[model samples]
Target: MFLTQTVPRQREIIEVLFRNGWGYMRKLLTGGKPEDPQLPTPAVLKKIFIDLGPVYIKLGQLLSTRPDILSSAYIEELSTLQDEVPPVDWSEVEVLIRKQLKRPLEETCKYLNPVPVA
Candidate 1:
């Protein structure tokens, strides 16, 4: 019932939940039962957040700050959640840099590395 046209990402979210073995969330999403809520293991939860992308990573980071809600183990694990973005191609980044500078990339910096450090 909840998996309607309006919520297009519902299916994807459910799939991720299922893949991560988050039984409680899967049940909640698919409207299986109204049982007590339960969370997966801390590491599993972190993996789920990672699979869900930036928004959920941010949510996990925020959740990590809440010592009252999560146990130390969960907080510790979630605290390490970093946004794992794929590296952008140097060509794309060079173009953006050129646009921002309103000039050639060479004119701005003498020795800019193509590879990202961070």
Candidate 2:
């Protein structure tokens, strides 16, 4: 009785492993190789999300917020990725600020605070 249940579980695990291995082999055979020859690791899906630009990043962040919709592991990984993006340069920010304020940096505020207080 117990053997019947265990056998199906074992077979399921084996099938999953086989499919994954075969898929990886297919990628290798098709020249879907990594750029780094010495450290040829599979392309990380998280890195893909990061590379896809702000839209995907925002989707991941929103998915992280929806715990009910996402799996626990997915939520955790996406949460970790929430703000892992590269910051825009200060120069760009300064330019935007000047444009919005319609004034030079010196005229914006008498006592300009570079960093905002919490």
Best by TM-score: 1
Candidate 1 C-alpha lDDT tens digits along 1-118: 6557747687677788899888887677677985888889999999888887768888998999999999999999998874444456789788878888999877778889998775
Worst 10 residues of 2 by lDDT: 36-45
Deviation in Å, model 1, residue 105 alpha carbon: 13
lDDT of 1 at 6: 43
lDDT of 1 at 57: 85
Tell me the tens digit of each residue's lDDT in model 2 across 21-63.
4445445546787343231122243444555445667777787
- TM-score for model 1? 0.62
Q: Whole-model Cα lDDT per candidate? A: 0.82, 0.59
RMSD of 1: 6.2
Name the runs in model 2 displaced over 4 angstroms: 1-60, 111-118
